[model samples]
Target: MPEVLDARALNRATLARQLLLDRADLPVLDAVTHLCGLQAQEPQEPFVGLWSRLRAFDPAALSDLLTGRRVVRTHLMRRTVHLVTSDDLLAWRTRHDAMLRQRVLGVYRTELDGVDLGELAAAGRAVMADGEPRSMPELARAVAGRWPEPGVRALGEMLVAALIPMVQLPPRGVWRVKAGVRNVPVSSWLGREPDPPAPDGDPVGETLVRRYLAAYGPAATADLRAWSGLAGLPAAVAAIRDELVSFRDERGRELLDLPGAPRPDPDTPAPVRFLPAFDNAILGYHDRGRIIDDEHRGLSVAGERVVLVDGRVSATWTVRDGVVATTPLRKFTRAEEAAVAGEERKLTAFLSGGDDQPTA
Candidate 1:
């Protein structure tokens, strides 16, 4: 019989893997790679994500990585923008192409109807071939005359997000800097194209399964699909099944995990953690019952910043005039309140540039 793990055990394992049990002493680049990537639809949120997970994380270091081309903000997993290492982008983009196109079409099917996708892709490449950064609207206008039926928003979204692999360049995501998105082809920005898909077996798919397990393992295939928005990884999982260990969840669903991955004890104490909007730690699984309650599940996708007490979401937090205000989802014990207050103070200091007046 596969070892049966309960929800608390799963929560502890998730907290450990997500670096929420304790802050990891790792460099910014390695941390980004380890988490696979930080969901970056809200540009500044990733800095906070890193701040919570890493020790003494310097936002400037992440900014430098962006300006230095070691990292990029691009559309990936779940057709959302993510802050990913350039190497992961190169290695993973091709595998995500079909899903990207399908998602765009799902949103803009009528507008994109009667359009030859291949030709539209060619025109988009031609427009971007000049090596100049362009906004989505601008790129769309440059080719809209040829496909006048589809409106600019529809055409532009498909072209910029799905057809062409593009990076949102700095200072769009630079630390403490605000700028509108300006896109350049990933190939031009990275000085090389994304890796081509294989003719035979799914190597990229296999890599994704391994990487997902490494970070969010002891997970079901449904959990993996939910995290990635990829419907096609079961084959990948099947191909590598022998290499993984399986366990049964309290629900009787089989969970797959990397052999040596940490599955911490359920009684292990977890500290107060402040997570940014859409933190993968909460959003990365199909069944989030392990870390968040069903009643509160909407909070994660709704983009509310949350506070974790004892490895489960306990409160929602927001900042107002340098004060971090927290609203409890449930009544907290005295110790939990103190831990949350202490962590919020640190978060406020981090947000307010080390100012001592950060009240919780």
Candidate 2:
């Protein structure tokens, strides 16, 4: 029988792998790659996500990466905009192409009825071939003549999200700067096309499994599917089965993990962590009991920023009028409150550009 990991053990291990146990000293780009990518639909949230996980994280460094094109905001895992290193984007985009298309179609199936998706994709690409970044509506209008039946919203969502691999260009995600999304084709923005799909094997899928376990390991196949929003990875898991080790969760479900990945001691102390909306650490598992209570799980998907206390979801936080307000889900010990206050002060300072106001 494999070792049985209870929820606390799983939580400690997850915190360790996620860099919450101790802030990592890695460069920004390397940290982003290690975690696969940060859920970045909110644009500035990745800065907070990294600040919590990294020591002395400079928001400007991440902004520079976006402007430099070393990192890109594109739709990848779960059909959401994520901040990913350019190399990962090039390597992983093709594998996710079918899933991206399917997700877009799922939302616009009725609006897009009678539309030839292939021809539409070609037309969309032609419009983007000029190498200029355009808003989704602009791109849609450029192609609407060919398919006037589907309105701009339906056509724009499909074309910008599924048909053309696009990067939400810089100035949009720059720290403290508010800008609307303007997209350019990934190929033009990154200076190279996405790597072609494998001819004989599932290399990209295998890579994703290994990467997922490295960051969120002891995870079930269902968790992998949930995090990635991709189906058909069973074969990928099978191909690499020999290279992985297994354990059983308290519920008797098998969990897969990389051989040398970190699984910290169950009793390890966990500091309070403020996570950005849609952070993958919380959304990465089908069974999130380890990191968040079942009753509070919906908060994760609802784009609520949560505070982790003693390694579990304990509070939700928000900024109102430059004040960081934290509403506790449960009673906090004096020590826990002190710790939360200390971290909250730092976070407020970061968010307000060095204004260390007390958290309400």
Predictions in order: lDDT: 0.93, 0.91
Q: TM-score for each prediction?
A: 0.98, 0.97
Candidate 1 Cα misplacement greater than 4 A, ranges? 355-360
Number of the top-ranking candidate, with lDDT as the measure: 1
For residues 183-276, what per-residue lDDT tens digits would candidate 1 score against the true structure?
Answer: 9999999999999999999989999999998888799999999999999998999999999999999999999999999999899998888999
Clashing pairs in 2: none
lDDT (tens digit, per residue) of candidate 2 on 82-192: 999999999999999999989988999999999998999999999888888899999999999988988999999998888888899889899999999999998898888
Off by over 4 Å in 2: 355-360
Candidate 1, residue 360: how far the Cα is off, in Å: 19
For model 2 the TM-score comes to: 0.97
